[model samples]
Target: MSSSPLASATFWLLLMNTTWPSHVHNTAPTPRGCASRARGSPNSSCPRQRRSATSPDQFVPRKAASYYDLLGVKSDASADEIKNAFFDKSKKLHPDSNPSNPELHSQFVELNEAYRVLSKEPSRKEYDLKIQHSYQGRQAFGSTSGHTVYRSTTTNDNVHYWEQFRHAQSPEATAEERKQKKKRNFRLVIYCVITMVLSVGAHAVFFRKLEEVHNSFMDEKDRAITELYNEAKERARANGFKKQTEILRQKHADFQEKPEF
Candidate 1:
């Protein structure tokens, strides 16, 4: 059957809506780079997403030499050994010996720095403690990497790069360290005194109790012995009195019988 113009238009609109793809309506517009990528173009100037700074691949492992390594001595090397190593290296790296070489001159400067720290007992101990606690210091000194770089900076820089690793203690810092040491020693002495006092007090109480028990036992024994001695003496005296009375009675009987005869 033939329909009216309005009815035909309405039917056509409904058909078009039903036939359209659902994704075309829902999808957002593609970016220019995405469109280029979809076209498989090689010359597209699309920027790639950069890797994160914290990504493992972004980190390049670097090995650095510690002062001990620079001096060619072990970390646990004695003061004498460190001094001797510095002297030996100094002879080779001295500016006068290698006048033309700038590299040796730099090494001589490093050698002097190492000697200045390691030659003294206080600075060396402090450096050792720092290396033990620091991660970079441990990696530098602990690792056996073949390519080890020693960090250096120009003298114009506010602080030398090596100074970051080891620097001379300020007078204030030295005084503070000494103060801490004295405090620790004082605490240790106080602890010892407290322990000694407690021990002596415990011993005195134990000994006093022991003496009281011993005295009580001795007094009881003495009382028992005295009672036994008194009982024995009273029995001996009663027996002697009975014997004398019997003798007197026997003598009187004999005298009466003689007078009657």
Candidate 2:
């Protein structure tokens, strides 16, 4: 059937309306067409969205040393004795002497630092006092901890009961306790000194370690960023960034005309 000219024109107009992008209905401040389209997605961006804080217990690396144990010296050792002990330990633990054990390398450097402090009269005295103070209030955990107040129910006299756990809890009483404490300190110093030495001498020199800590800290921050970006990108892909921006705009916008919910 031959259609009228006006009817044909109306059919073409409807076709054009279906195919073309219409802006007349756009009340958005950003002309919907103007936003830069997501190009080759970078998979990420800097200045990223913020996140909640993590717990302190989870934040730190390894446990810090008990400084007294680090020095591996008797609480009562004389200044000269401390110096000699440090000198002897340092030679044994120095990284040059032991190449196979990386742990030893770290310990070697740590021990050197501890000995360096212990050999000096002022530092040694201060360190000794500090150790004594750390142990003062707390009961010894075991013979190792210098806290030997044990309760035994077996056949034993009161005197025997008193002796079951050597009263080495008091630093002044047991020379053996002092010896153990000193030994522990030596081990600590050895570890610290070796760590320091290895850190310096390591061939690759973990660049991130330059940030006051070992390379691990930088790695942590990077992983955090990666996680954050991945999360955001997923949200962007699923919901579309334009809708997200609109929701945010409506939340913040204070237009006289009520904004569309």
Candidate 3:
């Protein structure tokens, strides 16, 4: 039987996932048993993965992750303390450090990804905002949700910055500060927990919302796909079963004809 367009697209995505080992990102440890199979090409060392922009979610991302979280330090941690933690984790997971182990290798890649974003001042700030946005998304659902996967976050610089702000006389504060005063919000942590619940009902609700928006955006495209599928089946019935191209063209022509609706 002919499949639907959305189903075809989903199938291809899954096939790509299975075919390309590195394309998949495992959240946790997985066995690295396949060597040649994992590489999938004659020249195994060839760079198979290209840097692509990540997909944008429907809602606007919040400014959630603070510098302390980026550096994985306590707000009160000394410079030495922060340095020690970063180096220790970096060394253990660095790709070069664990060449043979895929789990460690992936962790190593993640550590570097995190480090590059966190190390620079401007870049770090941008990343923190993105993190915060993600956090806010999760926290928005927090009251009933469970704990988020949290990393330690307490940095000396952050501690010092807050301390200075606290000391600054209220009368002399900057205009930006006056416009948007700082207050702690812990909603992301709640969202993080909610995600883990694997609540079918919760996901059904969320995806239903996505479906509503999706239907609004591409209702015509959806109808076209369904019509195309129906036509293909009709063609299969009309033409001899042996000829694929003939059936496809017949279906194609049928779809182009205006429907009464």
Tens-digit lDDT track of model 2 for 61-172? 4434543355566666776565556556656775678788766655654555555556557976786676676566444453344432322333433444344234322223
lDDT of 3 by residue, 132-221 (tens): 676687688773432233233446334433443343212223334554453222456677667777687688899999999998879888
Candidate whose TM-score is highest: 1
Number of backbone clashes in candidate 3: 17
The clash count of every prediction, one per candidate, is 0, 29, 17
Clashing pairs in 1: none
lDDT of 3 at 236: 73
Q: Give the Å error, residue 133, model 1.
A: 27
lDDT of 1 at 76: 85
What lDDT does each candidate get? Answer: 0.72, 0.60, 0.58
- RMSD per prediction, one decimal? 19.6, 55.7, 46.5
